[model samples]
Target: MTRWVGPWLLLTCVFLLMVGNVDPWNVLVGAGVAAALLRWSGRWLMDGRPPGKLGPRRVWGFGVLALAVLADVVRGTWRMMHVILGPSPGAKQGVVEVPLGERTEGGARVSALVASMAPGSVLLDIDWERRVMRFHMVDASRADEFRADMERFYRERQRAVFP
Candidate 1:
């Protein structure tokens, strides 16, 4: 029963997103589709893994991460605006390779996601074997700062939520 919650909520979200309504008929159809999809894909998705539970600590950690991301978004937006509207449009642009360090696969994925959420940076590639993520940044002159900030974020923010 616990295993069903994640898939059911995912399917419900997708159904609502696609159909854009919650009429009774639509809900019934969504439930039927969700059930069929769950039955068909449950084995592959579950993969004999136990369901994950979020305790208070994890919840608090997630909240902290969310706030940090929001702050990063605002700061990135302001910096991007300056770069765009400034006298010089040709700001230093390059890709920075950030070592994944001891981050788990899930933690690495979340790290990439959070890095991409910033306005001027995008996740270009992830090398699992090398355990590195490549990000293209608009202001690559601050590569060292960027790398340090990413390391801190992964170590401090993402580790608790995803590790």
Candidate 2:
């Protein structure tokens, strides 16, 4: 069924990568293992959720989101390096609360991933009821900047892609 394709493909690719081979026998073995795993755990993997709707606009939004995340990664990495290597001795570390704009579970997950992927930030806690996420920053002095940036990301990038 179409529902099985993603897990099967993902497992097959993982098996192939693990074995580092592409021979017919290897492919068959991978497929067999993938099938077994899917049979045993597919429901758990899918968590009873149906597939989300996808269209050209959503696809394009995903691309844009990827670029924006990439840019944030680079910027965060630079900031981290500066904190580690720069003459300024102590970079204050503290947590900052960022309000979540997207109400959907998918949007919240995407926002968490995008925020945590940046080197300078790590998602510490997500208060779903409060619609806020708390993040520990490498430099607490820049908490305002971090909050603003995350808000911008949620507004500009994550909402379109995940909504």
Candidate 3:
């Protein structure tokens, strides 16, 4: 399932995005072309491209993560505005690492984007071996609190999305 669905979806998206056609008819045609090419030719199946076995729970889990990101984005935007308008420079920023699990590529990307967008944080690097993400935050004193918040947030919000 992983092999089939991931690549199939990727093909659909890349083709739809790159074909650069806005009309519905054009998009349908482009999708048809992409599907034909992908299903008939793509030759990596023998060596790699294992099928991804995403189940209902996995899709449901991602929906939760998506909502969390949306809420975080809104909250972060307002917080950033306050920091900018308030009579103070941004707080003392330092990098902090967050331990993560084997989340999907979309999950990883969203996590990075949301972390960067949140009020006082920005993604610095991802330590895959450590299964953690390094983020620069506005305040250093709150590192423990920040880490705790992230850990809690992911535990509650990500289980469904990436499960």
TM-score of each: 0.69, 0.69, 0.56
Which scores greater on TM-score, model 2 or model 3? 2
Residue 146 lDDT in candidate 1: 87
Please write out the lDDT profile of model 3 over residues 1-163, one tens digit for every residue.
4566666666667877886765888667766766665654454342455334578877776787777877887877776677677777565667888767656544554466567767788777777777788888776557798777676666688645532
Whole-model lDDT, candidate 1? 0.84
Q: In order, what lDDT does every prediction score?
A: 0.84, 0.81, 0.67
Mind giving the per-residue lDDT tens digits that candidate 2 earns over 100-162?
775476566668768889897887877888988888887889988887887788888877767
| Count of backbone collisions within predicted model 1 | 0
Top-lDDT structure, candidate number: 1
Candidate ordering by TM-score (highest first): 1, 2, 3
Total residue pair clashes for candidate 2: 0
All-Cα superposition RMSD per candidate? 7.2, 7.3, 8.8
Candidate 1 lDDT by residue in tens digits, 1-163: 8979888878977997799999988888888878876764465466664224678988899999999999999989998998888887646888999999998766776788788998989888789989899999998888899889999988888788876
Model 1 TM-score relative to the real fold: 0.69
lDDT of 3 at 143: 77
**Better TM-score candidate (1, 2):** 1
